[model samples]
Target: MTRLSHSKHNSLDEKDYIETLSQKRNTSKSRKVLEVKSAALAAAKQHGLNPWSKDSLILYMCCFTSFLCSCANGYDSSVMTAINIMPFYQTRFTSGVVGSTTGIIFSVYTIGGLTSPWIAGPITDRFGRRRGMLIGAIVICIGSAVISSSNTKGQFISGRFILGFGVSILTCAAPSYIVEVSPPQWRGRMTGLYNCGYFGGSIPAAAITLGTQKIKSDLSWRLPLIFQCVPAFVVICIVWFMPESPRWLLANKHDEEAHAFITRYHGGGDPSHPVVELEWHDFKEGIATDGADKRWYDYSELYKTTSSRWRFLMVVFMSIFGQFSGNGLGYFNTQIYAAVGYSNYKQFVLNLCSSIVSCIGALCGVAVADRLPRRTVLIAGTFASAVFLAINGALSARWASMPSDAKNLSVGQGAVAAYFLFNIVYSFAYTPLQAVYPVECLQTNARAKGMAMYGVIVNVFGFINQFAGPIALKNIQYNYVFIFVGWDCIETIIWYFFAVETMGKTLEELDEVFTSSYPPRAQIRKVVAIKDDGHVDLVKEA
Candidate 1:
């Protein structure tokens, strides 16, 4: 009996010891979790910037200057859409506006774009973002003068070529500068806003053309052409006053300047602020003093590493997908409307109304840019665009062939509605992301060259779209719409399989994501603060 009682007591003691050990382990884990949560909350608070603050206002002003680049591009496109429908323009050109000649005139601009990236990449890297923008704007002003005064088709095409080249340089420099300088939390909205300026220029161009269309003179087209220079001129005036990108400063060894810039804009003049410290740390760790941006001819940096290749892949995908997704038809919206029994005057009205609706959609996109995941917005938007395009195609096929008097009024209106809906969905998905996604994907080292590469691809595909769209529209009519329907669906699948989620990370933190074997599948490791020393570390959650 004594032995039995002793054994039972020993077993009870062992069980108590095991239970105590388990309780201690649980306590340790709980403490660690609490520490992580506390640190994350602190970091969140540090990044919660006030938009109404003086520093934020200054940052916004700088970003707005960069946005003019997009506005310039939009104005030219919208103006051409309106001018193509004018009787004076057709009489002056004397080369039918419905066929291959129209295609050549439209495509010459993008051809000029194709020639720009080589010079733009090197100039932007060597001189600085501000100077690159200034040079491009100056060139645009000259191009505008030439085109507005042109008396011949060759002169008009040459002027447009110059305009394209200048716009390419502005596009590359402006987006890079905006991304590098914007606060990480506001990067999406600001960069997205940069592209939204497209609609800003478009709305005015449409309105001006609508007013000018009734004039029985070449000034109808010339006035709108001259207006293209306005946005670029605005950029040239304000960009000199804006601060240089912090990343550019850091990359060029202007450490003190970069630090001061960050402290003022990101930290509200507090050198010791957590946001300042974090930015400083990221710049120190991520930027290389002797990276590819420093070398004028080193294009290999974009493809030399697994991570960089993936980054460029995303750039390429976006460039091709963005241009091909039925928005290319935008430059010829009048023709699309004319096919459905609309008169020239009615076509101008529809074009103006469509531009306004598209602008609203782009603004809505800017609002949710940071709120939603990029992949979610892109996938949903592309799929929705496909559906609308298909609907438009079906309606156009049914009603476009009928005589105006015999056509079903409801069906014609439905087709127009479908076109309007398509613009809204396309603008919502693509306008905001056009510049934001490519800039976000590129690392500092590869940014300039990668953007140049992106420019080349965009223009190349843009050339195809502009040159071929008119021919295809004339030959296949509504069948061309089905092509995009199929292409957009394919693009949706590609985005689903390949697109990386870049919603919440800083430019530097993306390194971990890209460096992984497969970027799309890579998890964003949490950035945690070490309790012992105030340093941050990337920790994967269990």
Candidate 2:
């Protein structure tokens, strides 16, 4: 036996050491990860993750960058809501053309998101999470510049498409980077932080634009759109200093590097310790034994392998639910307000208030995510969101029928209150859940690819709903659209019953759940099951 020296005055006494050692042995034997990498590979791994154990400030900073990326995504998606209130769009296009124009703008961004899963997955696999982030920031900055300079709708839409492309790329890369770098105990909170920043970004998108509501110049909307470059610039400047995913290095056959990262990440300590070595061993063996070029992760394998299949279903369902449950409404909220007899300035204020409340909700959600089981929080939040939508839908329907009397001012106030309530619930529920859900559900091998597919689904539905909003608000009542989507709230029930908790569990533990018997209710109930295979079946009983 080799006697090792450790830092004195440590928490890990003799009993802790022996117990940790036993736990490591059991986990490694079960996980089947014990492998090696070349000398350079080992050195590269050591340089990055070596100084911090558990949670590093750098890890949090990296998460904050991810938060900014998500904020950019949220801000751009909703910035147009304020633009819709502007005379620029209204005077330029007819009522019939307005919906189509907005849809085109919304749809083009989705195209950018669609391209990233295919493009980003390979690069992140080959390069690293930090490089992927750096590239995304550069792309986002250029896109913001183009959008700011656009005089015509064509140029404007083109810039939006480019921005979407960058957002889509980060969607897959950021959370994947966070999960790999985060301690298991704190992963949920760290991941939730991105969503906090996401909605926080919405504040300036709404409030700043609303604050400039009095600005009659074309620069009003452009100012908000261009501000996106500020965060992009900041993220690009700081991201270079952030650590690359140690797991990513090990996956590329850099084990010694991985150990070095582990040492620095946890502070200088015995590298041979079970917990430290186990992560390295697992990363190496998992990549090597995967029996494919780690660079090209096949989506088809996501459904073929039991672990991958489970992740695929979770990502698919969550994405669908994310879009269906009024996320699109948030995108076009100003339009919804305009249709309800509010003036343009008032509509801007309403959107600002909603964003403000949502920002607060996102912060609270971050606090809650790691404390409870991931599924429980998701289930509760989804259910509460459904209830909020139901209330909002019912109020809108009644408001449509009510006569235009001064007495109805109270009802208008109530509608505004309900709308903000919906935003609050949505931020606490779907917003963070969408980010963390994919991270929690997928393992490292197919994680990026799976999230991209999820992003694709979300935008597909998003494009449809965005197109539908202006048309519905222009033709039918806003109430009808809310009612229609209020029904989609049932997906929450499916999620509550089917989605597994992955809060503190390891990837290997999560993998086992999908292999064991438990088909989501939709499959059992004969609802649509979109599978590559013709038939849908439950997992085998354990």
Q: 253-367, model 2: which lDDT tens digit per residue?
A: 6766766776666423556533354345345434443533264755665687665677788888888877777767777787667656788788888888888788888777778
Residue 500: error of model 1 in Å? 0.8
Per-residue alpha-carbon lDDT of candidate 1 for residues 277-359, written as tens digits (9 for 90 to 100): 65676677678889888889888878898988899999999999889999998998998888787888998999899999999
Task: Score candidate 2 by lDDT.
Answer: 0.65
True-vs-predicted CA distance for residue 27, candidate 1, Å: 21
Q: How does model 1 score by TM-score?
A: 0.91
Q: Cα lDDT for residue 270, model 1?
A: 72
Could you report the Cα RMSD, in angstroms, for every candidate shown? 9.8, 10.2
Quality of model 1 by C-alpha lDDT = 0.83
TM-score of 2: 0.82
Best by lDDT: 1
Model 2, which residues run further than 4 Å from truth? Answer: 1-55, 92-98, 267-274, 289-297, 482-486, 519-542
TM-score of each: 0.91, 0.82
